[model samples]
Target: MQAQRQLLFGMYMDAMRMDEVIEHCRTALITRRPILLGVLNAAKVVELRRNAALRESLMECDLLLADGQSIVWASKLLGRPLPERVAGIDIFSRLLLLAHKEGRSVAFLGAKPDVLAEMLHVVARRFPGLKIAYSHHGYYEAAEAGQIAAGIRESGADMLFLGMTSPKKEIFLGSYGASLGVPVMHGVGGSFDIMAGLTKRAPIAWQKCGMEWAYRLLQEPRRLWWRYLKTNTSFAQLTAREMFHPDHPFLAGANHRVTSGSPMLPDAQLRSIADD
Candidate 1:
């Protein structure tokens, strides 16, 4: 379970490669231990500044993957470069294929009703023999979170993929993910929409050029244009500031001190997840 990690802009991001992440989940499934997974991107990183709960939830996760190209670039500039970007969508797709090959059951939580149905249908079509333990749309009341969690637990799923938004998704998982009893749980934001064919992913060229955000901005300018503009700028400024002032409190290596045999540091942030 030991792996390299870097504290970037007050967030702990896993430096594990995609294969390492996949192997970790596979191990979690076999060992029956819950590994809450989170994906860090520019927008999510910006939100972490204002949302301590979100930050704590992410810190608690057993694995944190860099989902945005911007995050990968920032990690490099900060002098603790991640091996590569482990985009959430790519992980989701890869896990589905893995699940099919291994005969592991999965549960899906979140997305609109229509989108959820279409996504399930598409998953069925594409990944023949894949087991869908359970599915629910994201329209439920907050009060129903416990019931939803219970349903997922009862399904005896090996993996659970949540397609909800930021703080809500993180909070829900932090609140009930452990009790849900799923070994591999991940918050895959908006991936269900793309899986259902209701939304288009960026073209290969845009993704390769790290202009996927620009492509996304072009796709839904009214909804996403300003948001990305603000987040990208803020991330750039924050990274620059951190680069100059490397002694910012998050950079202090108190918890990162050498342990008995493992390189992994115990996280104080995850312990504070329920405080919010």
Candidate 2:
């Protein structure tokens, strides 16, 4: 079957659908093809894709998602507004729902033992029909990774969720997913704890306002301070530069012109959503 395509900002793609993501995995298993799910938070990881090597790898992927509202807005400016933001957590839930409906199998590898256990229970209870092929608690070394990879291969899991930290999860997926025969893999950083009720998501209002990062910093100041400081500072610089300059580097010739929004993008959108 030919994959359906959408014209996105300077790119062509299969129109991203939550259900179709899971369906693609099923199809890939039957057809023995490789597919990638590249999730992007435009403000956070957009710079990562600027590297020539990284950009090529991401574009080579079968799918990419505007996982952040900032990315959606950027896409609009780039002339390819994403149909919607595909939040990883939400997509994770949707994938489980589909797996339950179809009786497909899954395995989770990574996150602390307690987090993974509780998350597995929560997922199983939420989707009674879904099968958990297996789970291995996180905290493995490079040498031990082989064992976990072997376990996933042996379990016959159709989908795998790796809760390891950034680059690590991405590296693992890029390196081992095809060889392990898991057609669908998602890097869900720290999500197991949130999904398991061991940790809480920011309130919806805060998230909508893009202040969830603030709520998180309030909760884990010591660990997140420097990271937040760096990213948020870079975020502010990017926003300011883009807002003031008609010819900002980020806004070059991609999509809809973005000179009309408020100085702060999220605040601008929050105000608009509130008015609605």
Candidate 3:
């Protein structure tokens, strides 16, 4: 848990490690204050600039984690370096481990019907002690959202994971997540496909080199090539320009290399951001 807040690329980012995230998830489960976690990547940073509603919704999150290594690299160049990148998919797995260890009830929302069904099997096999309270495929009518929320609320799940796509996932969580009454919720786009083994994650080597986006492009060129090329190029160009700026405040700070040490955000603050 880290107390000091740093402004990076116009957003406030929390300085936390993986352990802290798991601890927070565990705490939220008992506290009834669900935490909205945003996984900020290079592409998402670009998306935030273009999508005001999405950005605003995400900005209201309880914690904004660096999902892309580029963000960690940028934090260094800016001089207030973050401890690490908290990859969304990685955190998703870890929280599941926590739930399984504690025997917590969980719920699933989003993804195609078959994919969601398959993911449920993967979850069962991987975490045998964990209980899935309820689940629904992502193809519901807009009118069904209230009913979905009611079902999730009634399920008594401590954690809810949404595998829906952008804007819709963000919007749904922002608008109705609190009403669903889950203590911890995360929007994990397409992680179900990976869990279902329909797609593969980047090899550890590529991930370590910060080229997972390239691997994704290699796998789905038609869908991701142009998106990654445009976002990565823009991110690089913008980061380079900021890194060299003489008057950047972070560059002038004396103590920039902060490692794992500090306290956590307040409950009220966390609750405030939990809403949009």
Candidate 4:
């Protein structure tokens, strides 16, 4: 689990492997702290630069799962290969199955105004007895953050899935978790759109081939082309640099890397950065 938390610009190495994720799902069923699955992609790491506080906030989560194939490839190149890519959609469905079996309830907190309502019906029909406590579209103005927090508190939801993008979800979780007492807070980018019948996941073959990003690009060419243009390129370049430059601080002194043998980075350097 610790092999992944390098400081590459506040990017998190995902903690749970596929088997571990399955185990955690089962554990959450019994323990009542619904698991918070964070899907980290290259774009999200880049987006972190805009909000320093949000990076720190995500660093405090119970778990972060690698949702992007690039991340898995990076870990492999770094000589710390992860077990598998745990996509957000896959984890969501896995959790739902666990919830169905355990009779646990869940709440949806982000999506288009009517998307959550539609999702509730779809999910309820698909998984009998799955309870949905409350849901809201994630279009609140800045002033309404507090009100949204209050709404979460009032809902008594066990697992709150913030279907917003990075920093937004992290900000919401870090701000609201203290008062709301929800056990899990999942940051599911675009999952609501998929759940609300607005988009489709790539085929299992495509996902397994690690071409899911390509499929998405084909689907939403105009909206996502620019985003992919920057993030994908930056990630590829940065990852390559890390592969060649072992001395880089981002890879050397990351928080999540498990330091088992010779240290990946000098302990003093790591301690200093961590102190700051």
Which lDDT tens digits does candidate 3 get at residues 114-169? 99999999999999868899999998999999899999999999888888766567
lDDT of 2: 0.61
- Model 2, span 1-276: residue lDDT tens: 654544432234454656667677668656756566766553324233233333343444567665565655555564544566666676677777767777778889878888888888888788876889979887778888878888999998877887765445656676676778776777665677778997677898976765666777788788666655655455445545444442322222234333333222332221111100
In terms of TM-score, which candidate is stronger, 1 or 2?
Answer: 1
Highest-lDDT candidate = 1
User: Residue 202 lDDT in model 1?
Assistant: 86
Worst 10 residues of 3 by lDDT: 267-276
Question: What lDDT, from 0 to 1, does candidate 3 have?
Answer: 0.73
TM-score ranking of the models: 1, 3, 4, 2
Q: Give the runs in model 3 whose Cα sits over 4 Å from its true position.
A: 244-276
lDDT of 1 by residue, 84-130 (tens): 88888888998999899999999999889999999999999999889
Score residue 71 of candidate 2 by CA lDDT: 53
Better of 1 and 3 by TM-score: 1
Q: What is the lDDT of residue 3 in candidate 3?
A: 48
lDDT (tens digit, per residue) of candidate 4 on 1-276: 333454333345554577677676566656766555566666654444334455566666667667888777777777766667888777777777777786766767776688777877778888998877767788778799888788777887766777776567777776666677666567676677777677777888988888888897798788666666656666566566656654333332245432221112222222111000
lDDT of model 1 at residue 17? Answer: 89
What's the best-to-worst order under lDDT? Answer: 1, 3, 4, 2
Query: How many clashes (backbone N, Cα, C below 3 Å) per candidate?
Result: 0, 5, 0, 5
**Model 4 stretches with alpha carbons more than 4 Å out:** 1-15, 32-35, 246-276
lDDT of 1: 0.79
